[model samples]
Target chain A: MNIEMIRAAQARLEGHARRTPLLNSPFLDEIAGRRVWVKPECLQHTGSFKFRGGWSAVSGLDPEARARGVIAFSSGNHAQGVALAASRHGVRSIIVMPSDAPQSKIDNTRALGAEVVLFDRAKDDRNAICARLSEEHGLTLIVPYDNPLVIAGQGTCGLEIAEQASAEGITKADVLVCCGGGGFTAGVALALEADAPCLRARPVEPEDFDDMARSLASGVIERNSRLSGSLCDAIITPQPGNLTFPIVSRLAGPGLVVTEDEALHAMAHAFSRLKLVAEPGGAVALAAALFHADEIEGEDVIVTISGGNVDADVFRMALDKFGG
Target chain B: MNIEMIRAAQARLEGHARRTPLLNSPFLDEIAGRRVWVKPECLQHTGSFKFRGGWSAVSGLDPEARARGVIAFSSGNHAQGVALAASRHGVRSIIVMPSDAPQSKIDNTRALGAEVVLFDRAKDDRNAICARLSEEHGLTLIVPYDNPLVIAGQGTCGLEIAEQASAEGITKADVLVCCGGGGFTAGVALALEADAPCLRARPVEPEDFDDMARSLASGVIERNSRLSGSLCDAIITPQPGNLTFPIVSRLAGPGLVVTEDEALHAMAHAFSRLKLVAEPGGAVALAAALFHADEIEGEDVIVTISGGNVDADVFRMALDKFGG
Candidate 1:
């Protein structure tokens, strides 16, 4: 929650986490009608920004706690992030994943030497299962968001963006980030508030799954009802986290939402022009930058591609549907 | 090209070109059975290593020479690189391109403010046409790879790899470079010889168009008889350049050739794992690194993804054919 903690998290994750590049595309700039700088977390360790938080949380633990290991519940970028971070420290990790989660995420988490407990999303409660496992094993629970340590870890991304943007002579800009449970968005908001006040951080989400956007607007935590099936499965968390909601609501500006079609188009553009593989969830901010350009008031805009671990079939479909 | 000229080129291209990241993948390392590092020039300005040569040549010109502008013949990465570099310098660039070249390349070159003169590759001598244009317009002729300034510009890639590898505690490495006219490979060879003698540079080429491989072995320039049908069209130069061959022959080790399938697989791996787009020609070195691991002898292996300017259809086929 503080800049010092974020700096500490950055130091803890240094050399382990990749400082993902700040990319610029003239093509995207043309579409956005301003300079567009992209922070591609798709290139991060474990193919997402989750690695920064995972490493920060895992590495920040006391040696005794680290030896006892950790447990968490997630089936997306967070699973692989925590798994990789735990393995790096020679600590055991157990990820409670949905039974029908993408095979790649499960396999990758296992490959990182983490034990995966599969539960049916329709029939079983992942949180209850994770709680039982954590208590039974006397393991620390590393929350996907909400946890101060995890938020501090995610805040490093904001710090990096500020430093890199400053280096590129970007003193002030409109920065758009993809929001899932508001973990990264809140962290980025806090970091920007401390380090680079010039960068106005906003959360972008899928049309139907705009929990964080609604939360910021209504001045309370919000939840998404099953209205429409979304392609951005990586970020379909039902509600904003208790801890993350306050940070985003207090520190961040307004949020934006983009359609599934727009996200797919952004994915295709990333493939063709930016030369980056972005999952649907990761492409939301880009969708906003490209499709809702007129609403973005700034000299420059920074969009974050949050992850790149989509199913092969899904990627092929995006390329087929929207690619030139 | 000498080290001094390369240093000068680096100085000239300080903020003009991107210092592309050298990426490592555990998945690639597991397949290669050794540590493998990749320098992705696909992230370079104009989407390829050609920009280095292009910028180096354009920026190296005297002020009056720059005023008359420059001309070159190529319908690939070079065309866009030259066009962009010339535009940056506020100079006129006339690109003599093949009529059948990819539309994306033509559009990009023209978008960068170059005047395009399309000619039949099968019927007209592109060099003759370029020469006539240069004479008529009093424009400086920028050879794609043969010029020392261009080669020196390309050598900056080698300098960066050495510096980055040394930072990672890599002392000795086997570097595989994609070869067309051997500008990049030869420049890399010279730069490595000067700064990082511990790293050995090797040339990689498409299977049938293995002119650099043959030239390295025979002590004479060997030409590929036919090239129109090759998938690696960006790098299908008939033979090694006169200026480049000698440097590569003198400093670099044996050359390697990869099949079109292998290059496509490399492109897919770059897409799926490294999260970078790589053209077929750009992916050849990666193919050599991944598939020809047994032949490489060093503490670590390094491969360069030289470009990312393939047509959408070509890229889609690469993803479908080889992606996970």
Candidate 2:
């Protein structure tokens, strides 16, 4: 929660994470009624922003902890991020993924040299399995969101955006980020507040998991259905993390909810218009901007396109739904 | 046509044209029956390698010629590339595009501050319009290909690939490039010959306009029908350029022809597995590698993914065709 810690993390991650291009989309600019800048983390190594956090966390660990390696529980982008980062650092990685996770995700993790243990989300507890693995192997548990280092690491993205925007003569932004455990949004808010103080940060979520939005309005943590099948598989968690919720509650702006259809439409639009392959979760923030254009009229906006790791079959289904 | 001139062009375009990433794909490597390295010009500015030629041609012009502006005629990626490069150089650009050009491309060109003059490709002479514009406005005609400067510019891509492959312990490559006016293939061949003497370059074309293949086999220039309504819109020209043909004849090893279905499948595979957006013409070389794996067996291979500028409707059709 320390702003200096976030700044230090940004300094630590300089040159390590790609300074992903802030691509201009005149097509999106025309449609949005304002200039739109896309921070394409989808082009990041491991095909997601999660790599930033994973790399930061792993690299910042004490030598003893680093020697023990890392463990993470995720079914998608984070799994790849940790696996790739750990492999790059010559550290072993153990990933606990749901049994129903897409074959592509599992395969990518394995390709990155991670040891994947599949758990049935419907019948077993992922966290318990992850804990067991961490304990058994004496590995450091690298939680996907709740850890302080992870949040600070994710903040580097916002730092880059602020620097890039300033260089482009942009002093303010209505920043939209897709929210799951609130880790990404909280980290981004902290960085924006520290750097581009005038910028506003908002978290966008699927209608099915509107807990973050509900929590923001009530100023309290909230939980949603544990079994909702949201279009954004990456952000379909039931609740925001405890550590993230506090930082988000104190620093984050209001949250917006977009329907599954809107997310699909945004994904198709991004793929065709911007020539970017944004996964459903990554497209959610842009979907909110598009679906609620009237609300954001005349504002200079920056949308964090989070990842590009969707299964081919799921990508086709989304494209079909959006008539692309 | 001079190899040294092409090398000079590569030097001039060093920092201007992106040394686009030469991505390694394990899946593609497995399918290619060799180590597969992809030169992703599809990720270049304006989403194609044409930007290289456009930049080189415009930058090499005398100051007075540059001040007078430039003009081109095209129905696809070339229009946007010229427009964007001209805008970057603070020069006026007039594009004589066919009325049937994809609306998205036309709009993109206009957005880059180019003057778009539309003519019916079937009923009117596009060259005549371009000539008249040049005469009236004193504009420099920047031919898309069939010009020495343009060929030199496109050669930079091949130079980058050869250097990058060498860095990765690959000294030789069976390079596959999609051919249109033979500009890209010729440029690539010149660069490969200069940088990696052991490398062999092959141009791949749609079966409908297999002039390059026939000409290479028969040792004579051959003309074919101007292919129309093909998925590979970017490379449907009737023949290789007069300047480029001789370079290809002297440097290229062979030519390959791919089916329309194979190109679409490659596009989809790029989208799904490689996380790249590849137009049909851009995917043709990859299609040849995938479909003709037996022919290219055990060879270190590099495919130039030329562009990523497909219409939304056409992309959807390709997705469906590939079961994406």
Candidate 3:
């Protein structure tokens, strides 16, 4: 919520997190008609920036609570990130996921040393399962994006962007962030406000799932009717988090929305030009930066590729449709 | 080349060359049965480490000579490297490539601000064309890996590895390099010899194109009988360079070789786990570290993914066969 808390999270994540580099390609700049720099958090541990938040929240727990173990609910990137964080801290983790989730996600979460509990999306109540498990095992639940410590952890990436941008003599630019529950956008907005005020944070989402954009425009929280079926499945939260909405509304710029095709195009460009793998959800910010250039203001823009955990078939589909 | 020249190249390349991170995956470690660190130079400028050597050679020329421009003969990575380097230096570049080379490579080279002159690989003499063009334009011909300055430029990667390894508290390990004309291996070997002496450089090549391994064992230069039919075409050189062979022979460990299948497998792993796009030739060192684990020594190993410029079909083929 504040710069000090984020800096405190940075202290906990000093050596634990990978300080991913800010990468750029002349070809991407040409396409965008402006300078384009990408912060590839896809290269972060567990192939996503979620690892930052996972570690931050896990490590921030009291010694007794950490010893009691942790629990989380995520069918994708968050599952893997929290699992690995808990495993590394020598703490047990119980992940509650929908049985309909990708098998690879289930396998990868378990491979990272978590005990995965699957529920039916149409039948079983996920929250009840998590509640029972947490109550029985005395496990602390690591919320995906609504927690303050988690936001602080995600803010570390913003600090890195500020420092890297300064080194590149980039004092002013729109910092596009992939938005879900808005923890990442809120965190980045807070960091940039305190450290690099000229670099404003902007949220980007898929076309149909533009709750953040609607909420920003209406000055009130908005909700999406559907969350599934989008190519950018990883960031399809129904609405922005209560804790995050206020921060983002105060400090961030107007949100932007991009199509699934634009996300695929951005993924292909990331693979071909930046040599980085980017899932559709992680690529929305990059999509906005490259395709929605007219909506953006500035000679240069910084965007985040938040994660890279796409299935092989989906990845091939992206490359096939977009030409890597 | 000695350490001083490499240090000087490091100075010149301080901001120009990307200091790619040494990335690792717990999954890769599980497969290798040891700690494995990968330096993904595939993320470097021009999608290869070739950019380092290109810039070093071009920038090392006298101001007057550089003003006259430069020329080079390459069918793939080298052409793009030199073209980008020359273009960045505000000098002209003429790249001589075989007409049979991949169309994407030709287009990419020209896109990087180079004049492309294609010759028939079967009948036309590429050297004759290069010589004539060099004489006519007063352009200095930049050799790919044989020049001392080029080697020095590549050595800067070794220096970075030395520092990164020391940071990780690794005093000893085999540093694997994907070998072609041996310039990269030789440069890294010389760098390790002076800085991280306990870390040994080892050359890795495709099974059919194991000229560096053969030359190291025989204590003389050896040539491959056929050069055109390998999955790792980017590294199928005829023989080790006259300048590079001696340095590698004196400083590096016995060489290693992996099959085309193994390279494809490594590429898949890089795509899935490391979020990196590695071409077949570039993945050879990683292949050696992973599938050829028994042939290597120690608890830790460092490997380089040299480039990422595979065609979409080839990449799809690798993914289809290896299951990215």
Candidate 4:
């Protein structure tokens, strides 16, 4: 992808994407044995970093295409992001979601003015339905991860981080971001590596998946199907996207995998100390920083808290696990 | 008592207190039938507006007094606030808390490096304990609300709201603040009324402790012993304070009372829609705005979310009430 395209996307998303606070936590700093800064995208509109790409992709369409509207397939944050973004721009949005998607996400998407079409993952194909909807309605398909415009939108989060850290006199740090299909981490790495040359970007994953880590070691993109039974549903994708894999390969400095227990612990920590309602995926980077403190000790670190859209049941489960 | 003293306290707290976000909620606006802005002090360090006063009071002590340390009595946010604030200033703090105070607050104060001295409210006099501790340790007593320094610190929150609203092109609005002992509301009123002459400041109370409302109607301070069995522990005080009453009387426009159900519903709404963890007391103002939509229709309004120190058990109970 052209770097200038990403910059243009950032420009288009300037006022739309929230310039979320880069909060400092002395307790977290102590826990990580490093100076810790959190970029709270969890506080972003639609409760996630998905809004960056959702707004970017939707807003970049030509007026005629925008008139036709947009469609996306997701069971989580991206659905709400697209719905909210499309509504904000006065365009219709159609979200194709799995039947088992959390009720909260479904309600939130519909509340944001989206037409939600549910398909059973056990009995039907979500991608095929989304494709059919896009074609039938003449709606532009805005893929959550594979699209270039989406990656560019996600990169705006990194731009904000670099600007905030620089303003606070922080010139160098290790940045940890949670990875699923790598859209968020890829975008963050590209922006941080380009603007803050001294900073190192590490993409973290659930130990169950770790496809990016495997792919990085093998010098080629690889797919894994062992991503199951994890508390972090949002980052349980089986493989990194083709478009994002290359960007991740070029920009990410290292790869780390954390246990599900670590993610739950981190989520609890965030709720108790920071008073933030971070979803499991959003807490993964901070979890890695805290659980693997020795590796990043004494370093200035920035963790991206990517979303705050956990299902009530999932949150309750996490609370129970952590003895809240 | 001196205006310059408040200015001096502000200067002392320049870099300490967080300039918390003033979030504009389109969802809340639609629900409240008005333009609503949330001043989220719940996101402040120690998860409350009390931190502003705590930090300011702790940091303002002379070197000799700082060396001697400080003492305070609180069962909730104020306890954590003083503990965290004193820790930030490297001053030792002793907190006299009710033994029945939530474990989260107790644990948090201990985590912040304060000595926790638990007392049974029914059997022990907390004030006597604090006095004895202060005398024994040569520590300065930091009263939570009655002190001028603490009031000045609390006023800084109002100062920030005024600046944030002005920056957002909101020249004036009716500001609703939840009242405990009246420090927070009085401080907010003072700052907003002084800085934005057209802004109206109103105090909100839980139906059980409608002391501010009764006082306003009677044109004199009134004390009540009736305690409403409600979830908002932070603002369930029996009456307004001597120091805070005069300030509140001079600056506040009117007082509003809201039901316990309204407070709980607001807490759930904030959590689900805004993704904010607001304690019940902190949400009471928003609750009034939400439940009393007709009273505030078509008006520009701002509500203060005073804290986010709700216990996990309390949160679960409230969520159950809201059918979560």
**List of chain B TM-scores, one per candidate:** 0.98, 0.96, 0.99, 0.95
Against the true structure, whose lDDT is highest? 3
**lDDT of each residue in A1-324, candidate 2, tens digit only:** 777777877777775666676766666777777778788788777788998889888888988899889999888888888887898889999999888887877888999879999998789987788788899889998888998888988888988888878877787767888889888898998998888987878888988788898889998888987645766888777788899888888877788888888888888878766678888888998887777776563368888889887766677777677743
**Ten contiguous residues with the weakest lDDT in model 4 chain A:** A314-323
Clash count, candidate 4:
0
Pairs that clash in candidate 1 = none
Interface RMSD of each: 1.5, 2.6, 1.4, 1.9
DockQ of each: 0.66, 0.41, 0.76, 0.51
After TM-score superposition, the amount by which residue A117's alpha carbon in candidate 4 deviates from its true location, in angstroms, is: 3.0
Better of 3 and 4 by lDDT: 3
User: What is the lDDT for A142 in model 1?
Assistant: 95
DockQ for candidate 3? 0.76
Local error of candidate 1 at A137, Å?
A: 2.5
Q: How many clashes (backbone atoms < 3 Å, residues ≥3 apart in a chain or on different chains) does model 2 have?
A: 0
Off by more than 4 A, model 2: A1-19, A57-69, A87-92, A166-169, A190-201, A225-227, A249-252, A289-300, A321-324, B1-19, B63-68, B87-92, B107-112, B159-171, B189-201, B289-300
Off by over 4 Å in 4: A120-128, A168-171, A226-230, A295-297, B1-7, B226-230
lDDT of candidate 1 over A21-132, digit per residue (tens): 7988777888888999999999888889998999999999999999999998888889989998998899999999989877877887898779999999789987889889
Model 3 pairs whose backbones collide = none
Better of 2 and 4 by DockQ: 4
By summed lDDT, the worst window of 10 consecutive residues in model 2 chain A runs over A290-299
